[model samples]
Target: MITRRMLLGTMVAAPAAACAHSLTEPEYPRVGAVERLDPRLDAIIAPDAPIEVLATGYSWAEGPTWVDRGGYLLFSDPPNNVVHRWQPGVGAAPFLKPSGLAGPIPAAVREAGANGLDIDRQGRLVMADSGTRAIARVDLATKQKTLLATRYQGKRFNSPNDLVISRTGAIYFSDPPYGFSAFDESPLRELLFNGVYRLAPDGSVALLDDSHHRPNGIGLSPDERTLYLALSDEKRPQVLAYSLDAYGMPTGAPRLFLDMSEGLAAGRPGLPDGLKVDSAGHVFATGPGGVHICTPEGDLLGIVATGKAVANCALGGPNGRDLFLTSHDMLARVRLSRPA
Candidate 1:
């Protein structure tokens, strides 16, 4: 029952107050200062949600997912190849190191694949692995991993970038050519186009779609009837939406969900990567300058003004009111008006 508005009543800090000028102040006139990086996003959320700095100082954080059980937020710092945990009152902690590989693998090559993560319907931690090109399970008790999927059409996936477990345990993930071996004699391997895939409970891998140039972020609609994904490749950069059938299978033609490159502050350093949704359906997506707020209808509400090309985010803290974020080299948080 914790909502974002309730958490903000206690005051939230902007991600970087040093570079952000609060519009709440009268002297700071709107003077086109509020940039909606994606032109299509201009109508997504709302322009008034005040942003505040939360936490900071990390290195290239990605893959943020919430763990309501532990009352903390978790995200991956890829360059460091580790997962970090954060709670509102107690601060951040080293939740897990050398996050396990999905399939049978050697210890030396295991840690390299840990990347995207999610909480399965069973309340267990699940993740996508670039190091191993597979999706895996993390037993809350022993932290043992059970491989879910890693191959399709007799070929290994390039990398499992991001994933989501449906209410029924169905697994969907994005595959890109970012996890292959570089003649390093590493055990990691990859194949196939940078695609979006689905893993059935029986370990069957389905190529959901391949239209994306390089899909980096993926999420389901609040109603579970649509698939929203981000294409990191500037050639086809966009937040695309796909219609789904009753079984949650994606069908029909995909459409431009949000062409961020045409947005207010389009020319920035980063591309869309990781994203999360709230119970009420608002999407907090990573953008060049910070987090971009979007309405369920794919309209842009506004930006959170993190002052960094935020990599990803998740809802945690007491009641999911805390917005945990990972910028290029920093981890931070803030109170929002919506809970995830």
Candidate 2:
């Protein structure tokens, strides 16, 4: 077993430009910096904490999920069509190959892999399979995959980008054409609109909303009463909060939670994408510059700037105090004062 501390020791001894398929060496001892915007931010993240680079050399790292039972962190590399597993004592290694597209795919297709990942209550690995254009579950023991939802109103989904499981066993996800070679213009696209959907426990699919141009990430509140959807569209990059009814369906009009138009105007690196909510209701959403920490009431707390285009984040570790971040080609970790 190779622990992070041991990896750090090896990193110091290796050449700075060493490029390995598994863990790429970092040029700097630490890759990025963190910013403390408000005093309240101190409650969650320590003021003097450093952001540690865990691994690198991924084509496009996204969809980080912590498996507490296995004591490992799993993340997706969409372009490579694989999922990598990172354990404190085991370093980083490929856990799944052909993660999304299992059958013959067109030659023009570029991205054919999974994106967002979550552990269901049954301890199964649930994934937003972009290549297959569906939500799937994988059995850890046998590596068998079961397609849970693939279509809405008889039309196949463009691509399932991100997903979150509610307390009631309901699955909420976003479908954008990101998997297509030309996005919406791709000839393989089936759905006319990008949608956010809910999959009931009984295997029923319902379209929550299709108004957003590009819905990339989806998360549920601690109480499962509010759903937060991140719009990756540059024209209207924002996070929208929708109130849920008793049956876990959206009710009334959705409200703007946080708008990143100013950040876009200032030329930040990323758009609104993957997000997660803490036990106290603070939303750590991947947005312009880094992960935006905001209150449930929509107050901007601070930003965890990775100095790169961060795609997604997950709370993990024994106490859930470790924040695993998936940036452009790098995977990083930061210990938080507050646990999720």
lDDT, candidate 1, 79-141, per-residue tens: 455677655545566666666443354444423646778987666788887665678887755
Specify the highest-lDDT model's number: 2
Stretches of candidate 2 off by over 4 Å are: 1-28
lDDT of 2 at 76: 97
Indicate which candidate wins on TM-score: 2
My TM-score estimates for the predictions, one after another, are 0.78, 0.91
Q: What is the number of residue pairs that collide in model 1?
A: 23
